[model samples]
Target: MAAGGRGSGRPAKKKSPTKGTGGNKRRGLEGRGATPPAHLRHWHKDKARTERVEREERTGGKTSAARPQTRTRRSEDAPEYIGGRNPVLEALRAGVPAAAMYVALRIDNDDRVKEAVRLAAERGIALLEVGREKLDRLTEGGIHQGVALQIPAYEYAHPDDLVSIAQEAGEVPLIVALDSVTDPRNLGAIARSATAFGAHGLLVPSRRSAGVTGGAWKTSAGTLATLTVARASNLTSALREYREAGLFVVGLDGEGSVDLEKANLLDGPLVIVVGSEGKGLSRLVAESCDLVVRIPMHAAAESLNAGVAAGIALYEVARHRRR
Candidate 1:
C-alpha cells in the first residue's frame, strides 16, 4: 500500500501541520466591532436622512438643508428661479439676465403675467409652459402665483478689480464692504445707495454674508445691474489689502469714537464696512478698519438699519468727495 493513500487499510504516517492564518479566523468570528449608530452606518436605508437631520440640528440651521427627494439641490453657480408674478415681472423689468421663463399651463392670466410674458419675449428669453405641479416643484413650493423666471447667477467682480475700475475711471475709489450683513434686501438697498452715491463697487464676505439674489435685485430696483458686487474670502484680510493699496478702511460702529461727518478719511480711496443690523461690526472687522465712525443718531433711537446706515454714510462720503 502506498503511504498516505486514500482508503488505505494500514495506518498512514501523520502529515506535518501547515502555517496558521495568524488569528484571521478568530478576528472574523469577533464581527465588525459593535454596530455603528444608524446615522453613521453607510448601508442603512435611513442613514443619509438621519445624518442630514443631525447635521442641520448641530448647525442650528446655518447650513443648508438636504435637498428634497423630488429634486437635488442646485449648485451655487446655477441659475435661480424666482417665483411669484410680481417678482417675475419685476425681474424682467430690472433686466435680470434670464435663461428661461416658466409659466404654469392653464394659469389664470393677469396683467403681471401678460407683461412678464411680453418682456420675456422681447428679451428673447425662452418661455417654457409646464404643469402646475412641475412649476411648484421648480419654485420649491414658493408662492409662485403660476409664474417663475430663471435668472443667471450674478457675476461677482474681484476686490482688486474694483480698485482698478475706479482707477480706470479716474475717480477716487469708494467701496462698500459688508461685515456680517445676511439679508439680500439690505444688500440690494445698500447697492442702490452705493450707486446713487458714486461707489465703485460692493464688497462682502463670501460666507455669512448675502449675495446677489432675486430679493436683492428687486430691492435694488435694478441698480444692482449697474453696480458690481465682489466677494472676499476674509473680510478682514480684504480690508488689510485695501489699506496696503492706499485706501482707508472705515467701519460703521455705534461706539465709534469719531462721527461719520467728522471722519476726514472718506475723501480718499475708501472702504466703508457696514456691519449687520443687530450686531455692529465684528471684532476682527472693526479692528481691521483704519477708523471706526458712527452715524449721528438721536438719543431716542437705539440703532439704525444696516441699509439706512450705509446709505447715510455713503451720502456723507459722496458729499465730502464733491467738495
Candidate 2:
C-alpha cells in the first residue's frame, strides 16, 4: 500500500510533442516538445540552404557557365609558354615537349604560322586557334610573331653537368657565366659562341638578365638549341656552387692583374664570368671571383660588349684547355 510500490509508480509519462508545430504539418517536429521558435526554425533552414549554394558556387558549380571568363584565367595545369616564331621553332627542333600551341585565327594560313602548326602536328602537340587578344595576353607583351608555343619553361642544366658533358666528349670543361648581362642579344651571342667552341655550357642569372627570346634566338642563329644553358637565381650563388664543384671561378674585368690569354684556364675546370657592357660586374660578383683577368686591348675601345667579352674569354679558355 505504500505510495512508492513498483505497481503504484506514476503512469508512464506521455511522449512530449516537439515544439513550434503551430498547427502546420510542414513545420512540425517529432514528439520531443522542444521545437525551436518558428522564426528561428525558418531562419536556420534558409541559412543552411544559402551556405550550401554558396559552397557550390565557390567550387565551380553548374551555374558557373553564366560567369564571364577573365583574361588572366589560365588553365590550372597549362604548361608555361614561350612565344615568337623563332623560339617556338627552335624549341621544336630541339626536341622540347610542347603541351599545346595557339595560332591566331586571324593569321589564316600565314606561312610562319602554318609552319608552326605543322611542327606542332609533327610533334604531336595540340594546336588551338585563339583570338589575337588571347595571344597578346599569353605573351605578356612579348613578340608572339603569330605563333605561340605552350612549352614548359626552359629546363636548365646544373653547372656541374658541364663537367660531365665536356669530359664525355673527350675535352676539358669550359663553362661561361654572365654578370648583369642585360642584352638578350649578348646572351644569345654568348650561347652561339659557347656552342660553336664546343664549350660545356653557359650560365646566367634568373633576374636582371635577358632570357632566350626571339631576338636572342636569331642572334644565336639557333645555336641555343644545341647548347646547354643554365639559369641561376643569382650569379654569385652560381659561382659559389661552381667553385664548390671543383671549378675555378675566373672573372673578366678591364682593370685586372692578369691578361686573359695568360690565365691558367687549361689547368683544370673553369667558369668565366663576364660582366655587362656598360656597368661591369657588381662589387659582390667581382669579390667572389678567384681572380680578375683582363682582355688586353689598345686605347681604342672603352670596353667590349658583353657578348664580345664572353666570346674572347671563352675562346681563350677553350684554346688553353685544348693545349
Candidate 3:
C-alpha cells in the first residue's frame, strides 16, 4: 500500500466547538418556553394609558387633579362611568341613569357630595358605600372625588330619524349638525341650545367626533334626555340628504360669504352645520352646504368656540322662527 494512501486522510483532523454558539443550552425541542417580544405581548400593562385617553376624550372628561387608578376590560360590555365631585353632582342633577351609585366611605362631606347622595336617594337609586380602594377599582383609578355612577352605554339615533321625528310632530324641523367637533363639553352646550331653541335633533359624525359621553350628559344639565342626538356615518352625504329632504343645509364658517343675520332660510326645515375649531370645515362638507354663513363679530375676537358659535346660531334661528 502506498504510504500516503494507507495512513492518510489528512491526519483525521478533530473539530473544536465554537464559543457563544449555544453550546451548553438546549436547542430545538429540548429548549424551554420563552417570553414573547414586547410588541408581541398583547397582555402588557396599558390599562392606565387606555383609561387616560378615554377620560380625556369624554365631553367634560378633562383630566383633573384627582388622578385615578386604572381599571379596564378589553370587552365593550364594561359599563360607562363619570367621576370627581363636579362630574358626579352634575350627572345626578341631569338625572343620568345609574344601575348603582358608589360613595366612598368617610368621604368629605362637601356640598356637591351631599347633593349627589340626596339626588340618588330621591331617584330611588341604590347607594353603595365602599372603601377608597374599591372605589378606585370601580372607576379604574379615576379621580372619583369619593363618588361615582355606573351608567348605561350612550344610545345613538340615525340621521334619518331626525326628519321623521319632525314630521310626526307636525312642526318645521330645526336640526344642528357638527362636523369634527370632538369636544364633549361642546356637544353638551350645543345640546342645551338645541333643547332651548326647539331644534328637532342633533347630528354628529360617527368618527373623529365626540359622542354623548357622561361629561356631555352632565353638561347638558339633563336636556340630553329629551333631545335626540343622531349619528351620521358620512357628513357630506348627510348634508346632501338633508338638502334633498327639503331642509336647507347651512354651514357656519368665519369666512363664509353670507352673513347669518339676514339669512332667510330659518323659517323652513333647516340644518345649521358647525365645523371644527382648528380645521373649520372639510372641503367636501363645505361644498355640500347650500349656504355658508358667518355670524357678525367685532374686531379683536377672531374666533368663538364651536359651542359658543352654535348657541348663537341656535338663538338666531329660534328668534327668527318666533317672528
Off by more than 4 A, model 3: 1-77, 84-90, 110-115, 122-124, 131-144
Taking all chains together, each candidate's TM-score versus the true structure is: 0.73, 0.64, 0.72
Best by TM-score: 1
Residue 28 of model 2 has an lDDT of 52
**Candidates sorted by TM-score, best first:** 1, 3, 2
lDDT of candidate 1 over 1-323, digit per residue (tens)? 57668777667789899999999999989887887887676678577676765444233234565644554444566566678888778778878788889998899998989999999999999999988886776565767888988777788888998999899999999999998899988998999999999999999889999998766876786788778899989889999999999999999989999999999898998999999986899999999999999988899997999999999999999889889
Considering lDDT, which of the candidate structures 2 and 3 is the better prediction for this target?
3
Q: Give candidate 2's TM-score.
A: 0.64
lDDT (tens digit, per residue) of candidate 2 on 1-323: 66655588766456787787566775454466777886779888899887665444233233344655453233323345567776777767766666788888767575666677787898789888877877786666677877777654456786567778987998766788888888878988898888877777888787888766544655675677678887777778878877887788889998788998888754577788889886788899998899899889999999999988888877777677667
Query: Residue 235 CA error for candidate 3 (Å)?
Result: 1.4
lDDT of 1 at 64: 61
Candidate 1 Cα misplacement greater than 4 A, ranges:
1-74, 106-111, 131-143
Error of 1 at 55 (Å): 20
Candidate 2 whole-model C-alpha lDDT, 0 to 1 = 0.74
Q: Model 3, 1-323: lDDT tens per residue?
A: 55446466545446797668564554655766788887777656476566674664342344457545575222223456677778777777767777778888888888898888899999998898988886776566767888888777777899999999999999998899999999888998999989988999999998889887756765787788789989988989988998998999989998889889888887888999999885777888899998899988897888889989999999988889888
Check candidate 2 and list the clashing pairs: 17-33, 18-33, 19-35
- The CA lDDT at 165 in model 1 is 88
| Alpha-carbon RMSD of each model | 13.5, 13.8, 11.3
